[model samples]
Target: MSKHVAYTQFIDFEEDVKIRARDQARVVALREKKGWLFRLMLGLVLIGPGVLVMIADNDAGGVITYAQTGAAYGIGFFIPALLLSGFIAYVVQEMTVRLGAVTHRGHAEMIWGRYGAFWGWFSLVDLVLANILTLITEFIGVTLGLGVFGVPHAVSAAAAIAVDVVVLLVLRYYAWERVSLWIALGNLVFIPLALMAHPHWSTVVAAFSTWRIQGGFTPAFLFIVLANFGTTIAPWMLFFQQSAVVDKGLTVHDIHHGRMDTAIGTVAMVAVAVALVILTGSLVHGMPGASNLDIQQILRVLGQRLGPIGEDLFALGLVEAGMIAAIALTASTSWAMGEAFQWPKSINMPARRAWRFYLPGLLSAVIAAAVVLIPHAPLGFLNLTVQVVASIFMPAAMLFLLLLLNDATIMGEYKNRKWQNIAAFSIVGLLVALNGVYGLSVVMPHLF
Candidate 1:
């Protein structure tokens, strides 16, 4: 039995190396295929991890953040700011692409192997806890969206769980990536919903010119700004993208495609976020008693303003956003755990072979779904707490990411340039400061 187990491990390792080589060889073949149109098609096929990560970043919780931003502040400040945030997200996430391609290791593995166990465990625990909490929010979004269609919360959650399980268990890595990209593309539903709102095009355009706040730096305004920033990039994003790149078998030669994938995703993410803000901003902004409207209330107002179809479409977008993010977050947790513990990890593995690798993510989704089924769960508070915890941990995650990216031995030619480090550290500084203020506000409400 021991010898059999060793044989299995040996087979898995050999298969892993072959898979990586195949990925690199495929890229070489595509490059040698010649025609621009064929290369374009090949590029599209290669687009997966980066696109998935960015869109998933604009999750259910993120939708709510954008909604609140628009409802409170109109289109002024946030629209263009979100676009800039997309670029910032790209800049940071781009490093993960290079790191994954060069090392062929997940972010967690790099930290554990290079930086030592203490930091490794710290990153792993932070990612797992955040993923769990964020998964709960995804379930909440699913339930809330489906609730509008008269589905019971339990049914909605159960269905979501089933879908997640099927996607993870039945699909290989390539199929899973393609399926996820298709689902993520559905996030465009928000664009039509925004159009349905009949927002003032001029007002939306004017926002970029002014880039000014309507209310001028109130505590409430600061809070929403931080929320937007926090949602745009998170610690899980770093783990998910790097692991995904590795799992997808990306190599340094394919880094350009990966960067393009991430760029496209960043645009999609920001566009969807801006659309949600516009949908709420145009319809509900400055309406009587609109200041404190939650997502349910916002949906209610949407129904009143744009009829049942508009409301239903918005709800559908919410459901898609939640499910897509749930998929990515679940996979992130699984990959992180597998990398940290040196377990076999691949979406391509058969269920029997990779059950241990897949179990953590599946169990997390089930648990989160079960929690959402409970009567009167404090979902709103839980969602806010997820964002706060993400902000608190963002600095540490970025620290490791920077450290890894800067390591000349590991990254070789892919290591961070001086400008990359400067920009990354600057972003980290801002996040740390924002987190400090946010923490203070939570701990001492009167101070803000």
Candidate 2:
């Protein structure tokens, strides 16, 4: 009688244990489903900064430059020339991906700490001046583009200032970046616009394959290429991406997604640049000495060839480009200033913790907006001002970036790797020498 009772009790215990195991499996399955949703959301959240950085990298200046390159050279050279530096961009930008992931520091802070105040102040001063002037140009772009749409200069400048303020004030970094990424999508319009030009695909193909140079590769072309490269890689991009990574709290684990984000960004930029070239070349090739085009002239050309709709679209795209760029440029100014001052410098930080960090960006944006709308503002002088200053300061800026990338103290194991340094230095040397030759050509007249 006792043995039968004990066996029955053992069966009861076994049934209870099996019920618990089944319940546990269901709970595990529920969590697994939740994880998939969480990751999808995070991936969307993680997408913007890299892409915005890349899109903004293709600023109004770049659009005009690519247009001019195609108008002058007919895409024979830069189609492939653009490809060469694309991975150079991918490789160079990838390092910032790692730096931001590992250190969670902005470029200013890294240089300041790794080298000293001397270099730190140097970088900060350069960034601040370049950023201010560059920001003014973005506003100029916005105003010019809006003018084509019949928006008055004073009204458009004021509206642009308002837009920048609202975006900076209302959103946390996450929301701000996502909104900006949507704005950045305007640049994609160039792809359809470019295709609408009815370019001979075979001609585009031949241009890349043959690598033809007009009148056989003059110094002027070299300078133009160097400037294009400069446009591709800027000091602010390094600062902006790193600060963005730090703000997003990207840690060692997120470096994979960050690098992937950067690769995607690199592709977006190169594609847009190529599209700009094709758009200009298809419409304006073989014109009577039509190489010297600028932003305002590009609109005239678009209006002439594609009718008012195409002209309006290009203007709208340019406005969008300037808007997106203004956001990044202002953010970069804020990040670098905050880092240099040792103030609370993160977009992730609560407002109180980082208001000092955020204030300078707001002020700089305001000043830039004001200056753009002033009557008889010596804008032609300002246009020359930006180029002269950028030319004067470019070498120093590139030197600091190279120095920082190579500094084992900052980058540690992630230092520029030998081959990367070769490309970097080669780019730097080429740019420097091209400037020299350009100056000579300008003075000599016949050499170019």
Using lDDT as the measure, which candidate wins?
1
Q: Write the per-residue lDDT of candidate 1 for residues 19-62, one digit (tens) a residue.
A: 45655576677888989987997797789998999999889999
Specify the highest-TM-score model's number.
1
Over 4 Å off, model 2: 1-41, 216-220, 349-353, 375-395, 407-413, 439-447
Colliding residue pairs in candidate 2 = none
Tens-digit per-residue lDDT, 9-41, candidate 2: 322333323423433343334435656776665
Assess candidate 1 and give its TM-score to the true structure.
Answer: 0.94
Worst 10 residues of 1 by lDDT: 3-12
Give the Cα RMSD of candidate 1: 3.2
- Which pairs in model 1 have colliding backbones? none
What are the Cα lDDT values of the candidates? 0.88, 0.76
* TM accuracy, model 2: 0.85
Cα displacement (angstroms), candidate 1, residue 223, comes to 2.2
Clashes of 1: 0
